[model samples]
Target: MGNLLGSWRFKEPSTVEECDSTWGSDSEDDEPAVEDDSGVSDSVSPERERAAGDSSPQLAEPRDSLPKMKRSFYAARDLYKYRHSYPNYRKSRQPNEYRNLCFYLNKIPLVPDGIYIEEILTKWRGDYDKLEHNHTYIQWLFPLREQGLNFYAHELTQDEIKEFQSTREAKRRFLAAYSIMLDFYGIKLLDKSGNVARASNWQERFQHLNESQHNYLRITRILKSLGELGYEAFKAPLVRLFLEESLCHNTLPNMQHSVLEYFVYTIRLPATRRQLLRYARQHYRPAHAFLWGPPPKRRGGGGAEGSVGAGSSGIRAPAPTPEPQRRAEESSPTASSGIIVSSHDAMMCQELGGEGLKSSAGLGSSMSRLEGALMMAGARGEMNDYSEIVPL
Candidate 1:
C-alpha cells in the first residue's frame, strides 16, 4: 500500500563523528572548550562556552565586545513561560507588566514582519472604547458633559486623567455636586492640611447616622470629594450650606447669618414655602390671650369699643376704650388680648377685603364673646373697608 502519511523514505544517516560540529549535542558537557588558534584551552565556564559557541556563527567575536542584544529571544521566552503559569494572564495583564512585555516583544525582529499590525489595531480600538465610555459616563453623571470633555481633552494633565479614570461613579457624583456647591457658596474645598477626603464612598460610611446627621455628612462629604477631584472643597461646602440653610427652615435662633440666609433662600422656592406654611400653622400660636379678636365694629353705629374706622388720611381709627362698667363686666385677660394672626393670614385678609372678616369667625369659636362681636362686625359688611385692617 502507498504510504498513507506522504512518501516515507529513510536515508542512511551520517556517523556521529562525521556530523557537522555546529549543531552540537543538547548537553552542557558536549560544548567544546574555548581554545586559541594553537588549540590551547581557555578558562571560560561551560555556560559561557555554550553561549559563545551558539553565537559565533551569527555574531563574529566575543558577545561582550558587541552591543548587548537590545532585546533577546530568551527574554521573550521567559515572559511566555511566566504568563503561562497564571490562569488570568491570557486575559488582561496588569498595566506595568503589559507595557514591559509589549516593549520587549516589539524589539524582537524574529516575529513575522507586520505581525504587530493586527495587535496595534486591536489595542487602538480598545483605547478608543475606553475613552468613549469614560466620556459617556461623565456626561451621564453631570450636565457639564462638554466642560468635562474639554477638561479631559485639553486641561487635564496625565495625572489628572489617571485619577479620573480610577475614580468610581459615587466618587464622581460627589465631586460634581461638591464643585457646584462650592461655586454656589464661593468657597474652596481644599484645606492647608492637604488631607483631602473623597465623597466617593460617603453614603456607605455615614449610612448609620440620623437624617439630620446624614444630610450634614453628605454635604461635607461632597465638599471633601470635590477636593479629591482637585476642586476647592471649602468653598463647595460653604455654598452648599448656604443654599441648604437659605432654602430650608432653621428653627435654631443661634444659627449664623449664612445659615439663615441659606434657609431663607430655600424658602423662596414655591414648594419650600408651602411646606414652611404648613408646618408653621400646625405649631404656631399668637402671644395674645384672646381666643378670638372682636368683630370689627361699624364706623358710626353705637361707636362700640375696638371698632376700626376709615379716615381721610387712609389710617384706620383705633378701637374705642370700653366703658369702665363694661370692661369690669368682661375682664378676662384672654378676652382683652387682641387676636393674633400670621403674616400669611393677614395678607389673605387684606387680599380678600370684607370676606376676610367671615374667615375670622371660623378661625375658632372658643374665642371670647367680645372678640366674637368684633369679628362679626368685620364679617357683616360694616368694615368692608380693607384699608382699615393692617396687613400682617
Candidate 2:
C-alpha cells in the first residue's frame, strides 16, 4: 500500500532554462522509434464521429421485397375493403306526405293559381281560335305551369308545351300535377283527324331533356305520363333511360323517387317488368324490398348448410308481385300509388339513400347480367336492343 502511494506522486514543471536546453537535445534517432501500421485510426475525425452519433437508425430489410403476385394479398384481408352501406329504397316519411298523384290533386285546391280554371278559360275564350294569339293567356299559362298547376296547364296547346321553359323543380312539379290531371280526366291529345297524336319521333324532340340537371325531372315526368298512359311507343326510350346512370341516379331525392315511381308504373307492363326485375336481381339490395320483397325470411333450420346450398345455386327465385297501382283519388299521398311499400323497404332505406344505378360501368355490367337473365326467363321478345343508344 505504501509503494502504490509513492508511485502516484505528482511531477513538478521543469525550469525555463532546463526546458529550453531539453527541447531539441534529443535527435530523431534518439527518440524511441515509432511504428506505423495503416494509420486507419487517424482517418476517423471528431466531425465524422459527431455526424455518426446524430444519424437516425435505418429500417430492417423487408422479408419479401418482391413477392410473386403483383396484387396485394393483405388488401383482401382488410374487412372494410369489401364492406359497403346499402341504398335506402323507401326512406322514412311523414304520415301526411303523399306519394300518389290522384290523392294529392284531390286534396289540394283546384285553383292552384288562386283563380278558378273555368274563369281563366272564359277570359281566354276569344283566343281559342288562335291559341298563340292570346299572348297574355299563354304567359299566364306558363307561370301557372311553373307553379305546378298541371290541371289548367294541360288545357294549353302543344305550342305551350314548347313555350314553357324547362327547369328541374318546375318540370317535376308540372309533371306531378299534369300526371294526376291525366289520370283523373282520361283526356287524350288528338290530331285534327281525331286520331291519337302518335308521332313516332315526339320523344326525339326532347332527346336532351334529361341530359342536364335542369331538365331531368321534366324528362322523368314525361316518361312517367307516357308509361301511365301505356304508351308502348316510348318503351324503348324508357329502357334506354334506365340504362343511363346519370338519369337514373340523381342528387335530388324527389327526382330519384320520380324515377323509381316511374319504374314501378312502367313495370306494370309484363314486357318491361321482366327486364326491370332482371336488373334488380343482380343489384339486389334490401332497399329494393319494394321490387324484390323482404330478403327471403331466413330459415333457422337450414343454418349454415342451407345458406351454403342457397349460395351454391347463385341464383335467386323470381320476385313476388309489386304493390297495387296508384289510386287517383281518396287515398293518402303516401298510399296514393297503389304501390304498397312494405315497412321492410322503409327500414332498409338509409338516411342518405336513394342512389340507384348511379355508375355507368356498374349499370352496363348489371344490364348485361339482366340481359342474360331475361334470355333465360324466355323474355327474348321483350329484350329490345339498347346498345347503340345513349339517352343523353
Candidate 3:
C-alpha cells in the first residue's frame, strides 16, 4: 500500500521564479499548472501552450503582402524600361489634368470660312432640286453663298441635284427610324438640331445596311461624335456599343470599305487612309491586320496626287497601289511573298533554344508523371506522349 501511495504522490508545483525564467514574467501569473490523479507534472500550462501558437512570428504578416510587393517591384521595373526606351514616352505620362486640357483643345472644331462655305455648298447640292425651279435658291441658302461658285455649280448639276435630293430625303427618313431603334437599346444620339433622338425598331434597317450597303450609319455617328473626346475615351463607347450589339459574332465583310465610308460620309471628316488604319487598330480588334485584303491598284497617268487634285480642294484621291507596293517592298524583306512574322516569331525562336528545350523536356516528364497518376487513380484510361509538340 505504501509503494502504491508513493507512485500516486502529486509532485509539488514549480516556483514563480522557475515559471518566469522559462516564459518571461508577463506570462508567469497568467499560466496555471495541471496534474492528473496520478500527479505526473507537465512543464507547459494550457494557456502558455495556446499563447505559443497565437504568437507565432511566422503568421504575423498577411498572406497578400508579399505578392503586392512583387507586383509593385515589377511595375517599377517596366516603367523604368519604358522611360529609357521611348523618346515620346514622357508626353504620355503627363498629369491627368494636363492631358484633359489637351484633349478639350483638340475637340474644338476648326470651323473656318472655307469649311463653312463647303458645308453650305454640300447642303445646296443636295436640296436644290427639291426646291421649285424658281423657288429662290439663294434665299434658302445658309450664310455662305458667294464663295467658289463655279465648283459648286459644276458639282451640283441638274441631274446631280435630283439624285442628291432623293438621297438626302431617304437618309433623313432612315435617320429618324434609326434614332428610334437606338432608344430601344438605351442609346441616344443628339442631332445637329439640338434634339436628343433615339432609333426605331430598325432590325430590318440594320439588315439592309449589313447585307446591301454594309454601312452602319447610326453606329458611325456614335463613333464619330464620341471620337471628338479623343482616342482613349472614344474606344470605351465603341467597344461598349459593339458588345451590346453582339457584333463580334459576325465577321464584317468589306470591313475596311464599310468602316472608312462610315467615317467619310457620316462623320464628314477628311480622314486619310493612314488615319483609317490607326482608327481600325484602336477601335477594332488589336489582332485585325487585313485592310481590305489587297487594296486595288490606282490606275491613270499622274498617280494619287494628280488624280486627287491636291490643292486645297479637300478631296483626297485613293492611294496609288504602285507607290504602296513600293513602300511595302522597301519596308519588308519578304513583302512580295506577303509573309508577316510578328512577336509570334520571337516565341518560336526561344522554343528552339537550349534552356527552352530543357524546360520543355521537364514539362513533358511532369506531364507523363501526372498522366500515370491519373491512370492509377482511375481518372483516366490511357495516355499518349506529346513530347514532340511544337511551341508555335
Candidate 4:
C-alpha cells in the first residue's frame, strides 16, 4: 500500500525542461529552419523577409539635367524671393524697363475728340493767351480742324498761323478755315493796310485746282465759299463744273441739293435765275418744277424793260393769259382767219386792240388775283415764282 501511494504522487518539472518542451516541439514542427553559428537564432520572420525584398540600393545623380530646370530646389521653393528683390533687379536692368516712359513739360490733359468750337470758345471765353502758351494745347488744333471747327482755327495767332501754313496737316485746315470765315462772317485774313491778303492767290489756286484736280470735298467747300462771297465771279465756273464733272453723277442727291441751295441762296440776278431754270429744265426736268416754281407767262410788247429789272423792282406785273382762245386753238380755231398766233404775239396784238382784246378792267382784275398768289407763295416759304423779284 505504501509503494502504490509513492508512485502516484505528482511533481512540477524544472524551468529549463518546461521551456524546452514548449519551444523544442514548435521548432521541430517548422520545416528547414536555419541554425545560428554564433549560438544566436538566425531565423528570419515573415515580416523581415518582406522588408528585405522591398528595399533597393539607389545611385546618387544630379536632379536637374536640362537648361530650363537649372534652378536649385531651395531657390524654387522660396517663392517670395522675386517679389522682394524685383526693384533691385529692375534697377540693374534700367535701360529696358524705362524705355517706354516719357515725360513732357507743361502738358495738359488731352481734350476729347470731336469737341465743338462753340463749346471750346465758351469754355475759354476768347482768352487766346492760355491756348497759345501751351504747346500741348496747340496740338489739339489739328484734331479740331478735322472736326470742322473752322471758326476757332480762324482765330489762330500769328505763330500758330505760321505753324499751320507750314505743316502738312495744315493745308486743308487753312483753306477750310479762311474760306468759312469769309463766307459766313464776311471777314478775310487781311494785311495791316486792310487789303485782302492772298485774294488773287486764292482765286488762282482754286481756279487751277478746278481744272487740274478732282478733290471733291475741297472743291465743294471752295465753290460754296466763293459763291457766297462773290456769286457773279463763281457762277460760270460753278455751272461748268456742275454740268461737265462726274461729281454731280456719282454723288447724286447731295450734289444736286448743294447746287440748288447755291442758286437759291446766292444768285439774285433775274437773268441768272432764268438761265439756271432753263438749264435745270433742259437737263433735270424731274426736279425743274420743284426748283423753279412756275414758268414765266407770255409777255406782251413793252415787257422787256420789266423783265430786265424784275429782280430790282419790288412789285411785278402779272401777264394775263388768253386761255379761252389758246385752248380753242389746240382743238381748232373757230375764227374766220383760221390761223393760230403764238401766245406772245397774240398778247401783243390784243394789247394793241387788233383782235381778241379783253377789257382793261377784266385784265386788271385777273392781274390782282395773280399778284395775290405770287405774294402768298413767297410768304409761305414755298418755291419762289420764276418771274418774282429777287432781293439783292
Candidate 5:
C-alpha cells in the first residue's frame, strides 16, 4: 500500500482558480466519472525525475527541445475512451433508456410539454383551418428519428416504427392526421381505398398552394414521415396529382420544380422512386428540361432503364435493378411497397400526353417561356436550396 501510494505522486485537487484554464464545458455530473476512473496523469519534469531517482517512465516524456509549458490535466486524460460517456450521447445512443419513451412506442411522453399523440389528432379532426395555421404540431404528427424544427420533441424510434406498424388504432389516428393535412393542401385522402386525389375544395387549396411558400417543405417532411412509419402505399398518388396539376391543368406552376426535384426523390423506397421516375418520363415534355433540371440519363436495360443514377453532383440515383422487388426492406431500411401514380393517372398519361405535346406546337417559344418561368421560380424563392436525405 505504501509503495502504491509512493510510486505515483498524486497531487491535491486543484482549486477553481488553478483549474480555470483546464476546465471546459463538461457538465458537473461528468466529474464523478472522471474521478472514479482516476485516469489523471502524473506528468513530471526531468529534474523531478532525477530528484526521485527514477530512471524510467511508462508514458513518453515531453521532448527537451520543446518549450516547457504547463500541460492541461484534463488534456492528459484518455479522452476518447470515455468520449461517448457524456449524457447526451447516453440518451441518443440508447433512447429507450429513459423510462419516459415515445408515446407511439411506450405510450409515455419523453419531452417536457408531453402532448399525447392521439390528443393532437383528436383536436385537428376535420378542422382544416387549425391544421393549416398550426406549424409546431406537424413535427409531432410526423415524428421522425432526426432533428426537426421542434427541438423539444423526441424523435421516433425503431421500436416506435415496429410498434406503429402493428397497432391499428395508432395507424387510424395517424391516418386521420394525414387526412386533415391532405385536406389542408386541397387533396382528399380516400381512407377506404388508401389512395388520395384532389379534394372537392381543391380550387381554394390550389390557390393556397400558389401563395404559401413553406408548404413544399412540409410536404417533403410529410412524405418522409409516411415512409418512416410504414404507410408504404400512400405517397405516390399525391405526388402524381401534384405533377398532373402542374403539367396538364397548368395550375400549380411553381410546384413543377419541387414535385420533380424534391417530392418524388424524398420517397426512400427505390421501387417507388423508379415507378414515379418512369411515369414522369412518360408525360415528360421537352419544356420540362428548362423547367426542372435536365432529366436523368437514359441507360440500357441491364439495370432498370428508368433507374435514376446518382453522381458526385448530389443526385440520389439508386443503382438500377432488373428485379424491382430485389430491393428488400433489409437492403434499404426505408424502402416500402407503393404505387405513387394511380391507374387513372396512367390512363390520363396515355390520353392527354400526346395532346399536350401536340398543343405545344411551337417548341422554341415554349422552351423560352419555360426558361422565364424557371428564372421567376428562383425569384419566387422556390429553388432547390434544401436537398435533404430523409434517412432511417
Candidate 6:
C-alpha cells in the first residue's frame, strides 16, 4: 500500500476536454467531426474546429513561388504592348450648358449679357486688334472640350456634340463662325463646305497672323473645338495646310518644332494626328541621314510673316496652279475623306506607357508621350477620323 501510494501522482487538468465542452456541441449546422488521436470525445465539425482554431493554432505551410520565365526583347515587347483594355466612357451630360451652346450656335442671345455667337464672328471680323486683344470672344466663337481661358464660359460636353450634329442650321452656323476666323488668318472657308482656300486678301491677313502672338493658341482652340463638336473634317486639312507651308515649303521659317509640338498635337482625334505625323515623316526633308536638324530660331517674337510664307494660307491653295495629276479645283493634300490612316501604320501609343513596343525613329520627348495618350483616346471605334484623301 505504501509502495502504491508513492508511485501515484495527481492528475493534471485536461484542457482538450475543456475545449471540447466549450466548442464541440455548438456546431448545430455542421456534421459531427470524427475523433482525432485525443481520447476526449468531441462533436466539433471541421468548420467549428476552424472557428475555434485560435485556441490551438494550426498554421498553414508556406508556399514556394513559381520561377519567372526569361524572354527575348521583341518577344517581351509583343507580349506586354499596350492593349487599351480600358476606355473613357462618359456617363452624364450637362443639360443647361448644352442648351447654352445650342443657343450660341443658333445666334440666339443668351440671358442678361444678350451675346449671340454671330455678333462676335461678324462684328469682330477682320479686327485683329479686337480679335487678338479681347480674349473672351474666342471661347464663344470656337469653344473647347475642356474649359478655355475664359472661366465664365461653359466647356463642351458629349451631349452638346450629339445635339449640335443632328441640327443642320447649327452645323452651318458653326462653319460660318469657322469661316470668319479662317478669314482672319487669311484663309477662306469654301462656300457650302467646311473646306478652306486662300482668301483673295491672303497676304495682308496672313501677315497679321504671322505677326500676332495669339493666333497659334486660337488655332489650337479651333482644332480642339472642331473635334469636340463634330466638325472633325476641318482638323486634318488645317493641320496639313500648316505642315505643308511650314515643314515642306520652309516658307514660314523656324516653325517646324512649333507646328509639330503645339499645332498638330492639339488635335483630339488620334487617327487624324497619326495621319498628320505620317505626312510629316514623309515631308520632313531631314538634312542628315541620321539626325533631324534643329528647328530654326523664330523671329518677331514668335509671330511675323509676309507673302503666304511660301504659299497660300488658304484652305486649299490652288497648289501652284495645279499639277496634271492633281486638279486645281481638287481639295488640299490633307483633305479628310481621302486619307485612310491604316492600322498597320497605327501609332507608337503603347510604347509611351512603357509596355515596350519598338520605339519610333525620331523626336522622342514628353510631348511625344502625351500625344501618344491622345492617340489612344481615339483608338476605339467609337469615334471616326474625318477621312479626306490626299492625292499623294
- TM-score for all models, in order of appearance: 0.16, 0.23, 0.21, 0.23, 0.49, 0.48
Q: What clash pairs does model 2 have?
A: 88-349, 98-333, 98-334, 99-333, 99-334, 102-328, 324-338, 325-338, 326-337, 326-338
lDDT of 2 by residue, 90-182 (tens): 233333432222122233323335443344433533232333222222222223111222434322222333333233443344444333322
- What is the per-residue lDDT of model 6 for residues 18-136, given as tens digits with 9 covering 90 to 100? 21111123221222353222321223455442332111221121111111111122211211111110123234366665754666655466433567776765686777676666666
Q: Candidate 2, after superposition: displacement of residue 217 in Å?
A: 3.2
Q: lDDT tens string, model 1, 1-392?
A: 56753454423223211111111221223223541122111234555423322222333333223221011122222222211221122233234432212221343211222233223323423242332222222222222111222232212223332445455643444343434333322233465422233244333322321222213322332332233344432332344333333333332212322221122222112222223322222222220111111223334433322221111111122223345644654565675575544435544433333112234322212222211121222322223211111000
lDDT of 4 at 353: 23
Off by over 4 Å in 3: 1-189, 193-200, 214-256, 261-277, 283-392
Please, what is the whole-model Cα lDDT of each candidate in the order they appear? Answer: 0.27, 0.27, 0.28, 0.29, 0.48, 0.45
Global Cα lDDT for candidate 1? 0.27
- TM-score of structure candidate 2: 0.23
Best by TM-score: 5
As for candidate 3, its clashing pairs are 178-199, 179-198, 179-199, 180-198, 180-199, 180-200, 181-199, 181-200, 182-199
RMSD in angstroms between candidate 1 and the native structure over all alpha carbons = 41.7
Residue 314 lDDT, candidate 5, scale 0-100: 15
Candidate 3: global Cα-lDDT? 0.28
| Model 4 weakest lDDT span, ten residues long | 98-107
Q: Which stretches of candidate 5 lie over 4 Å from their true place?
A: 1-119, 282-392
Instruction: Name the lDDT value of residue 6 in candidate 3.
Output: 48
lDDT of 4 at 288: 12
Model 5 weakest lDDT span, ten residues long: 307-316
Q: Candidate 5, residue 125: CA error in Å?
A: 3.8
Span of 10 residues, lowest total lDDT, candidate 6: 308-317
Prediction 1 TM-score vs. true: 0.16
Segments in model 6 whose C-alpha atoms lie over 4 Å from true places? 1-94, 105-114, 191-193, 266-274, 285-392
lDDT (Cα) of model 2: 0.27
